[model samples]
Target: MVGRTNIETGKVTRETALAAFSYRLKTAVAPLVPCAAAMERLHRGARHRILSKGDHILRAGTVADEVFFVHQGLLRYYFNDPNDGGQERTGQFFDEGIVVTDAESFLARVPAKQNFEALETSSIIVLPRTVLNAGYDADHAIDRFGRLMLEEALVGSQRRASRLLTLQPEDRYRLFVETRPEIARRVPQYLIASYLGLTPESLSRIRRRIAGQVG
Candidate 1:
């Protein structure tokens, strides 16, 4: 739906712009939404970025002083285990229409304990944390926008943690497939397994079971 490249600058294409606009309309504005002024200002402030698969958006232990909204492609939030020879522990996957950032680091102005890597070629809108702060202070609409984004992000993080703790592995896999079919459809099996807090072998077994159950 949102696949377009800029003609001259080639940074933020027209289609992605519309994508961001649509995202704001649906997520920020549509529900309890107000005027479009705040969302427009935020969109204008965004710096568009394109990344290929495997690009590192944020390295571990670095300060994530920016927020990014994905317009196309996918990103994975993860940690590389030094003790386990840098084995990746996938924390989360973010796709289009979603904002991705190191929330704890952004809020606390501290180093991130995790890394953000591109799972596929991605188009994203980057907004500096300082800019967002200034906007929040200056405009009530922007403040409301920020609150909504943060609230959703927090709720998602909580839900992910709670489900992982409470659900069985297969149930987690099922929930993932049910809730985030887009991610499940595109991401590699091992990474999906990692995100589901299961080993690849376990996931394979679960898949087999699911197939049998469905069949």
Candidate 2:
């Protein structure tokens, strides 16, 4: 956590910064496999950020120049459909020890096409794309870290895509609980409903039905 506050930036070091970073890195299977020097480089680029609930970490159509590792709380990645009176759809939920990024934009070095917002007050470590790029140039270990991270992200996206196409809403909810029960408990019901592509009432009914079966 970062502690000291910058009067101008409204940012403070929450004191658990380094520990949180370490925790996240441990969960990052690829980053941890890198050499010691690469790990050092990664830590150097990390800066702690404390955000309030509803903060916009990444807005749609903006340049994505950094990647964030969640240290605490939850975040939701959502997009708006302008054509149909600005309907919102959540695409992803990120919790502690997770990395969240707009896939195409972060890698392609283009503007992000999606928005990421904190679902609760959150803490994170930010690493700019420039720093990561330089680290990759300096060490083969760091390059491998980057590649592995990308591969993990790709696999996650594919899983979500497949679920959206093939699974019914109830099956999707069950699979979500099976895969990310912690997130299901921490995130709001509405966001979970959005992620499962269901309305809140429908989710409620599904939950009741499932509970009846279990009982």
Candidate 3:
């Protein structure tokens, strides 16, 4: 059992983390594999990992060997812009109940272009590629799940790319807030600005304008 100390209470919360992981796994996999035994077999080798804020689970130039399911806290997927003095440009934020990974890197066995970093103390379930591959080969439902996950990832990537290329900063921010209000609320303003391809000041102005309109 993997656990971390609760910062406020200074007590290990292993059971809480475990319970969250189990619940999230079931919620994610149950629709694809309704059978209890098959779900168990598919996730047989999944393990828990705890990451502190600023920890990099997957970094640029490294192949992603595992898929992570966020059970608690937040994660950021970003890449450094070489032309902009290696400025970190946020790609996406993964919060509770999200599955995260550099799918291309994991599938192609190539170095990742972006990094996966914990934005806060996070508990995640790690599914190793080897175990997942075995499950995929052995179970038809597991294979379908994998295929659907990859397709979703691809579609999400394309959508993000299109938004960045076509949308105005304010529109981008609005769409982001509309689609992922929880992430917008939880993430730092500057990081959110980066994700939307806007300056912090610009994002602040946009937020103020939006608030004024709402009021």
Candidate 4:
């Protein structure tokens, strides 16, 4: 899949990429108050970039100077646990149409604790921090958009933390599958297991058990 996507990505021209990104940006801001000036400011600084599968867009100990909007493909946000032999724990997945960034790191001007990696060949729009900040100061609608994005990110983090603290492993997996069936299908089983805080073997057993109940 990665190879196929890379080939397709190589064929995309700058003009084509910018047009697609423009459409996505417009779509995202459509529900908010329309501000042509704000839109133009955003469009002026945005540019397209492509990452092959396994590429890291952001790494630990580095400040997130840019925000990414996923125009195509999948990305994983994860961190290494020193207490657990540096084992990687998946925190979140960003698919098409989602914004990707380490919000705390970006906002506080601190090094990021997590990393963002491409799980599949990905096309993303890169928005520099300067551009976003300028937009916030210049337009009320843009400021509202930024605030809403951060709020959503916070809510997602809180929900994931709550689920991990309160839900059993099997229940977590079941709920994840029920709510994010597309991600369950698209992501590898092992990675999904990690995201659910389960060993692959345990996740396999849970899957078999669920299948048996269905059958």
Q: What TM-score would every model get versus the actual structure?
A: 0.85, 0.84, 0.85, 0.90
Name the regions of candidate 3 deviating beyond 4 angstroms. 1-38, 41-44
Worst 10 residues of 1 by lDDT: 1-10
Per-residue lDDT tens digits for candidate 1, residues 1-215, read 44555423556674566566455645674445544665566666767777888898888788998988787778999997788898889999988778779988989989998889998788777888877776677666667777878889889989988998899998999888898898899999999998887899999999999999889
Error of 1 at 201 (Å): 0.7
**Tens-place lDDT digits, model 2, residues 114-174:** 9989887777788888878877887776666567677878898998999899999899999
Clashes of each: 0, 7, 0, 0
| Maximum-lDDT candidate | 4
Kindly report which residue pairs in candidate 4 clash with one another: none
Cα lDDT of candidate 1 equals 0.79
**lDDT of each residue in 1-215, candidate 4, tens digit only:** 11123435377544555566555555556666647787777878877778899999999999999999877779999999999999999999998777779988998989999999999888888889999898888877677767767877889999999999999999999999999999999999999999999999999999999999999
Off by over 4 Å in 2: 1-15, 22-38
lDDT of 3: 0.80
Hey, what RMSD does candidate 2 come out at?
4.4
lDDT string, candidate 3, 73-151, tens digits? 7999999999999998998898876777998899899999989999988877788898788777776667766776777
